[model samples]
Target: MKNYDVIIIGTGAANIVADAAIADHKSVAIIERGKFGGTCLNRGCIPTKILVTAANRIREIREAAHLGIHVESVHADWAAVSRRMWHKVNENDSIRTYYEQFKNVTVYAGTASFVDKKTVRITDANNHTEEITGTAIIIATGGRTHVPSVAGLQESGYITSETFFGAAYPPEPYKSLIIIGGGPIGCEFAHVFNAFGTHVTLVQHNIRLLPKEDESVSAYMLQQFEDYRIQVHLNQDTLSVRTENGEKILTCSDRTNGKK
Candidate 1:
């Protein structure tokens, strides 16, 4: 059994607590099941937004004709976009190296679960297990997408934000995309993929996209999505998704009147 003054599970925002403890001469163990940085850094925010920025530029150029400025043939290379984004995020070794530089800190890569209060077990990739006990253990395991229980959806190979951005080889720029859930992530992806020349259809169960935002703002954003040539299907629940003849098709029901 390994012993430490502090055991911080998940190298995310919560793991920053170890910095102060380590500064006070306390030995700390930073446990992470995945990469050194958490979701925002590795998969979610940082890298995805960078791609979004590039997409925005493409949209601007394509729309430049309306501004009386003729910028011809502005194209977005999506495979290049996905490739470069991952290349940049995966290339960073600063976080891991910085943590390793301190003799008082230890980094463990494995799945961690509590055995008892103040005791935890970590199972690595090879299934090798080890127990670590600490005076204080902090769990900062971040969130993952929760897929809903829908018939044929899972087997249809539907892609979520995580799998799309986290894959080793992302899809080679599909010509069309049907994105469900028109909240922030879905809207952002709608903009990105639409800007990348993909025909995007955004479906939302709510009456409008961005349900959590102000009503006026949501309406304006929906207008913007329409202006971007994105097909918007509001107040519709996806009944099922199935691949038919080498193409995936999504069936939906109008939630307002309970009709398909």
Candidate 2:
């Protein structure tokens, strides 16, 4: 059993804590189940923003007429965009290599389970396991996507924010999309895909999109979506999802009127 001064679970925000501990001459152990940079670097903010940047350029080109700049054509090469995004975001190995240079830091690439208040067992990709103890344990594991309990959703197949930039990412923009949420993630995807010429249908259980935001902001977003021809269905509760004859179908209920 190896021991350290600090055991940090997750490579996300916990990285900051690990650095601090190492700087203080304390031995540090980091357990990461996935890539080194965590969600933001691997599947979240950085990658998503790369796509968003392309989407923004497309929007600017389309709206350039308002500035009296008549552009003949605007083409979004999804292959090129994806290549660039992956090239920029695929730094996991580099991150791990950097951490390995530190003599006092032990990087465990695996899932960790608590054995006690100050001990954890880590199981790596090959099913190898090791027990490590620490004077203190820091849990900086990030949040995950909350899949709603809709019937046949799993069987129908779906991708959450985590998988959107992962192996499940489509080679190109989908022809059409049925987004089942009205929160930030759903709205952002709707905007990006719509800008890329995908017909988007957004279903929200709440009466308005961005329910957590101020009502005025939600109204403004809805108006913008309308202007962009993104179909917005508010007060909708997704009841089921199924693949029918090679087509993905979603059944939702009108929350206000109880209509299907």
User: After superposition, which runs of candidate 2 have C-alpha atoms over 4 Å from their true positions?
Assistant: none
Query: Candidate 2, after superposition: displacement of residue 107 in Å?
Result: 0.9
The digit string of per-residue lDDT tens for model 2 on 1-260 reads: 89899999988777889889989999999888888888888888888889899999999998999999999999999899999989977787898888889999998889999888878999999999999999999998888998999999989899887887777899989999999889988998999899888999999989999999999999999999999999999999899998988888998999878899
Positional deviation of residue 258's Cα in model 1 after best superposition, in angstroms: 1.9
Give residue 133's error in model 1 in angstroms: 1.1
- Model 2 scores a C-alpha lDDT of 0.90
Q: How much is the lDDT of residue 137 in candidate 2?
A: 92
Please provide, for model 1 over 1-260, each residue's C-alpha lDDT reduced to its tens digit, 9 standing for 90 to 100.
88999999987687579788878899999888778778777878888798789988987888888889898588677777877787777743678778888999988889998899989999999999999899988888888776766679878887776666666335666688888888888899898888877899988889988999999999999888888889999999888888989888988889989787
Q: How many clashing residue pairs, candidate 1?
A: 0
TM-score of each: 0.94, 0.97
